[model samples]
Target: MSLRVLALLVLLSIQNLFAQQLSPEASIRVLTIGPGYNLNDAFGHSAFHIQDHSQNIDMVFNYGVYDFDTPNFYTKFAQGKLHYLIGVNYFDDFMLMYKRQNRTVQSQELDLDTGQKQALFDYLLENYKPENRRYLYDFFYNNCATKIRDVLQTAVGEPIVFHEPEAFQPQTFRTLIQDNLKTNSWGSMGIDLALGSVIDQTATAEEHMFLPEYIHTFFSSATLGNSNKKLVKQDKTLYTKQAINSNKSSFFTSPIFVLGVIGLFIVIITYFDFIKGKRSRWLDFTISVLTGVIGLLLLLLWFATDHTATAQNYNLLWAFPLNIILGIQLLKKQPKPWVIKFLKFLFIMLALMAFHWSVGIQVFAPVLIPLLLALVIRYMYLVYYLKNEKL
Candidate 1:
């Protein structure tokens, strides 16, 4: 027999033996980190903490780690093809990092027998291996927080009953996300614009684990299938977040204020052009171009990407992609008669957008209210001007 083959067999046996000998004193914990001020950190994070007193081993298994150096990183991220990997860190280092960020760190020890603990530990070690580490990340489903719930189910080899946390109210995926963001902030507006109506659907109780805070709450009340034993044995606050001075952005710099200013300018210009009975071709051209470009990007996000959350976007109603061609036609001394119909179509699209919002099909950014009203006025003015010019 080859020495290499014999050595490999012996190594595999040793690994199996070590896995089986997981100390009864070992404990598996779920760590929940509080949200930070940044948009990326708004949702918070979750990880597995494995500590074995007998073996003097303490490590953290994190599913949120991603490499910025991956090929076509930005492009893949936009396409929703980015991969996140499991990363192992020293327990102290993990706690210290979150502590420095002034984020609250909470830990929940699981109530599991030695067999279940060993199974979970072995599973994490297997997942930590290079070839098995990376997985496709999804914001609403297979993310860092969801991984905690998933790994527990897998290791325990049973369905987990995630009971509703106290005072738990069912909320749409979008609502759940917006709960973590300020209403008039640019971050919230961007999310409303980029994501689509799919997020408007209410999330199931078990599905709410996609957020770290929910993971902590749900796991606290979770139990193994057909068993009344609680999933979490105890909870501890490792580091309480310290209150800091408010660094909120100025109100003038907020999305509502900025967009409101721009919208008011458009309305004032359109009113003047209506009184003068003259079309402000430059202003119309600029608005059409900007809205058209944004619409095209939204369309691409819906159609050309793997993002499930970007489907059926309603923002395109106001920012019509066909406006780009209409803008170019307006630059002509004599645009075709069809331009009038196109203007009317844009007005109808605005009305439809309102209808969707009212009927709860989709919820648009509140910051866009002023801009939408301005678009309606401009479209109506353009239609009247084109009709009078033809007379």
Candidate 2:
């Protein structure tokens, strides 16, 4: 062979050898971040940490990143069609952001062999490349937590046997979510109202890994494929929250208290009208319009969105879209003949909602109890008034 060919072969061999060499000081860890004070961060977050002392590299690979500048950002996000990308950030920068938020951060060092560690690191580097990074985000099936689980299993080229956490009990997705939410908070109520029957079904043990906390818990005892060897070599807290009273929220401002006050107002107006044998068109109109608009939103979530949890919602029974038409009719001194029939239909729909609640078909927001009761009374009176009022 020519000297040029020999030199080229030598350079190729050198590159290959360098690529295969992962420094003994290199470490691979999974970082689990605790919840923040926002709906989006309520469930927590997960990311991979890669540090090599010899290479002067310490970076975090985050799968939960999305570009806000993407075309039709809000629309695509609402429809669940937005792309989430893997992002590389310096370890200090990443930890600083979380610390500033006062969120707890925990790190788990993985028990990966040198070859496995390099394979995983190389895979993450490739995934961080612009064209290779973006992936379709799914709440339950795929997300940051599941990404870590999948990457570790793939890197090790072995099945990871995730032992169930000691505190884990079988639970529905909604219940699992509720564990993080304050019972009477708007976030909890909004989730219950927006989501549907599908979330009520019991989630399997493996399915619970969709949440970051569960991912951390299960991986604590996870073993390498058919071996007694553990997946995590060591676990330690990267950051712990300092006691800060300023970050606290008050229960008086919560959804339950606010909704209860509104329910009381509705009941007073409704009761006074029933006793006086006179209907308050404005109050009735407000109820219909409010429920109707919410119903329309729920309909869009169920049909137009790619969110699986929003399907087959039973909240529609109470917040019917027809309430808008009925509300418009309530504006007339003498409504059309169909008005009474529609009122009756609404009352029956409320009954069906009660059945669903009792049978555990769909669990609604507990904060809605007073409002629901008031609606039932108002709806009943509307049916009676429309039938008995002089035409």
Candidate 3:
């Protein structure tokens, strides 16, 4: 064997030896970091903390780590093909970073025996190795918080009975997400637009751990398989967040106000066309083309992207793709019979959207209320205009 290969083997052996020798004073903890000001940090973070006073070892194992230097980073991320890796850093450094951000930091020390603690620590080290670290990230099924929950359960080699928190109730994935965001914020509107009806289904109780705060709550009450003993031994708050000024927002820039204005403008134009006994071809073409484009994009997201939550989108009911084909019919002075039928279909689709919302099949963004009303009124006028014209 080459000298370099032999040295590498020796170094790995030494590292394994150290991992197996975790002292009785060592503790394995779950660290939950509170939310921050950005969309990415809105859900917060979860990590494993390993501390051994006797051996002078204190480090955090984080599964949410991703490198921006990765090739084709933006493209891969958009396609949901980005790989996230487990990273290790000193505990003090991790704490300091969150402190600087003014985010609350909390810790829950697991009630693991010395053998279990050593086993978990060793397992984490093995997972941290280059070959095993990187994993495909799934937003709902496999993420930072879920990883911590799964790893801790695996380390215990027991069925963890995660009891539902007292305040827990069933909620859809979109509702859970919107709960963390401002109702009228750009982020919320973007999420509603980009994601489809798949996220409208109710999330199961155990599935709620996808969020860091829920992980903390569930783990606090979880127990070992069929045992009365609780999983967490102690809970500690490492840092309290300081209040920051929150009066930095305005209503005019919000989606509700912006879409509302557009809706009002559409209504005014339609009323003018009614009085003149004429249809605005430009406005009709624009709305048709816009909805057609949005429909095409939603279809692409549903079929092409790896995003699991974008399937079965009902938004296409209102943003019909057939509008592209029907839009050309609007330019002609004499409308085709098929065009009138298509207008009726568009009005029906709008009604179906309202029905869907009413029956809780899917909940759309509230910002769309005014826009939907305008669409219905415009379609009704178009149908009347075409039918009343001389054949």
Number of the predicted model whose TM-score against the real structure is largest: 1
Q: What is candidate 1's local distance difference test score?
A: 0.89
Score residue 315 of candidate 3 by CA lDDT: 89
**Each model's number of backbone clashes?**
0, 0, 0
Question: Model 1, 222-275: lDDT tens per residue?
Answer: 897788889899999999999989687999999999999999999999888878
TM-score of 1: 0.94
- Candidates sorted by TM-score, descending order? 1, 2, 3
Instruction: Write down the lDDT of every candidate, Cα atoms only.
Output: 0.89, 0.86, 0.86
1 versus 3: better TM-score goes to: 1
Candidate 1: 10-residue stretch with minimal lDDT: 9-18
Clash pairs (backbone) in predicted model 1: none
Worst 10 residues of 3 by lDDT: 10-19
Candidate 2: regions farther than 4 A off: 1-21, 250-252
Per-residue alpha-carbon lDDT of model 2 for 1-391, expressed as tens digits? 5746754654353334334456877899999999988989999999999888787667788797877878999999889888888876668878998999999999999998888888888888767666788898888888999899888888778889988877778899999999999888888999999999999999998899899988889999999988879999999999997778775678789887788888889889878988998889888788888899999999999999998889999999999987898888887778789988888888888889889989999898989988888887887888787778854
